[model samples]
Target: MGANAAAFASLLRGATNLSQCRWILEQLINSRYAGDIFLGNLALQMFGKLHGIGDARALFHRMAQTGRNLFSWSIMISALCRDGHHREALGCYHAMNLEGGIEADMVILSTVIGVCSALQNLCEGRKLHDRVAGCGLESDTVVHNALVSMYVKCGCLDDARAVFDATPTREKDAVSWNVMMAAYSSRGKFQQALEIFNDCLLHSVQGPDAVSFVTAISACCGLKDVKQARALEELSCSHGFLETSVAVQNSLINLYGKCASLSEARLVFDRIASKTALSVRAAVMEVMLRREEKFCHRFVIAFMLPSILMWCLGLVF
Candidate 1:
């Protein structure tokens, strides 16, 4: 029976679609292994992955009747969040707390804090923050990052910065720097955003990724500092992001356009093999609105007419 349960568990892991999962689950039930905690957790995860939330909830209730474990509760809460049921996800966490015996781990805490971030429930997020301290998980990097993100999304930059500063230097990852930079940029604190960017380059263990470059370029665009924008362009190029990431390329085009560097903007736009409508619009709008020279307007119109038509035809999305 143990060998059969292991084979069924393996099959559950490999199941791709809802149909396969349901069939395997039926097999487990017939084999009298459906109530097994480990197999039940696997089924719960598969149902969640396949968007079978209703099935997941049903299975969760059955597991609860027989006594659900931490993994069971965590899977259900995460599934609820993924399906955009943030309120329900919080409710699940609360129910887990009421049931006792299961200590909240980093995975569950991070997920529930993210639910608060999504809902912008600052009050609940604070409660969770207190809970993190109570459970002695404040030093966990994953939970700390989630707390920072929650505070940022809630429009509490001071709180976010406090958590960010408290995060151990070696534990800080790309997400930590990117979220802080983006928060400052979104709030029009462009200088602060750039400061965070510079710090990330100096201190982050894994260094910056595409998002860091985009956010920093956006801050330069806000300041209209052409020299800084050019420096970032060069840095992005050195990082090989300019040629690889469409988001970084698009941000550069917009940055140069806003800085009134039409030639630089056009150069970046011309390099994109798969230009988005944003890139096309950014390039053409700058040319049409800024350049008073009739010949330049005509040249832009002629050069961009094909892409404009493609955009109109819904082909260049």
Candidate 2:
């Protein structure tokens, strides 16, 4: 029985689609090992991977009748959340808690926190924050980042900053810095955003990525500090983002356009190897709106040419 159960579990893991998975489950039921906890959880994971949430939920209900474990709950909740069923995910989480034996671990905690972030449920998010504290997972960097993102999305900057500051520096990843920087930038706290960007460079081992540069450049744009924006342009070049990231290029174009440095903006726009509609629109809008006397003809040529070409190619949907 043990060897047969293991073989069925292996078959389930290798199953690539719903039909294959169902065959394995049928084999398990016929073999009278369908109730095995490990096999049951493995089946749930495969169902989730196959985007079979409906099937997974049915299996979960059956497993619950016999008994479910931590892995069972985690897989179900994660699958539901992945499918954008945030409310349903929360419902499963509450059921798991009421079940009253399986302790919530970091995996479920982070996931549920993110569900709250997606739903923007600040009240539920705050309750989960306390649960994290109770579980002694407040020091976990991933959980801390999730909490920060939740608060920021909920418009709770103070709470986000509190979590960000509490995170140990050694554990802070690029995500940690980017989320905080973006929060401040979006709130019009440009100087604070730039301060965080500088601190990220000086302190974080992970340093910055393209997103960090984008946010910082946006802050410089908000302040209209051409000097600082130029410095950031250089930094972006040094970090190898200027050549690779279209987002960084777009932000620079907007920054230079806002600063009335049309030449520099044109330079960035001209260098894009593959110009997206956004890049073209940014250049066109900035030129037409910022220095119409200088680039009015250029805007008509730049914007209309590509748009006409896209329409011809049936790509303008």
TM agreement with the true structure for every prediction:
0.88, 0.87
The TM-score, computed over Cα atoms with residue i paired to residue i, of candidate 2 is 0.87
Off by over 4 Å in 2: 1-7, 14-16, 270-278, 291-317
* Candidate 1, 66-110: lDDT as tens digits: 557999999999999999999999999999998888888989999
Q: Residue 271 in model 1: shift from native, Å?
A: 5.2
- Which candidate number has the best lDDT? 2
lDDT of 1 at 170: 89
Give lDDT tens digits, candidate 2, residues 1-317.
Answer: 47888788779989999999988887876777867888899999999999999999999999977668999999999999988999999999999989898899999999999999999999999999999999889879889999999999999999999999988898899889999999999999999999999999999998899999999998999999889978998999899999999899999999998899888888887777777878878888888787565665675576678778878889645
Write out the backbone clash pairs for model 1.
none
lDDT of 1: 0.88
In terms of TM-score, which candidate is strongest? Answer: 1
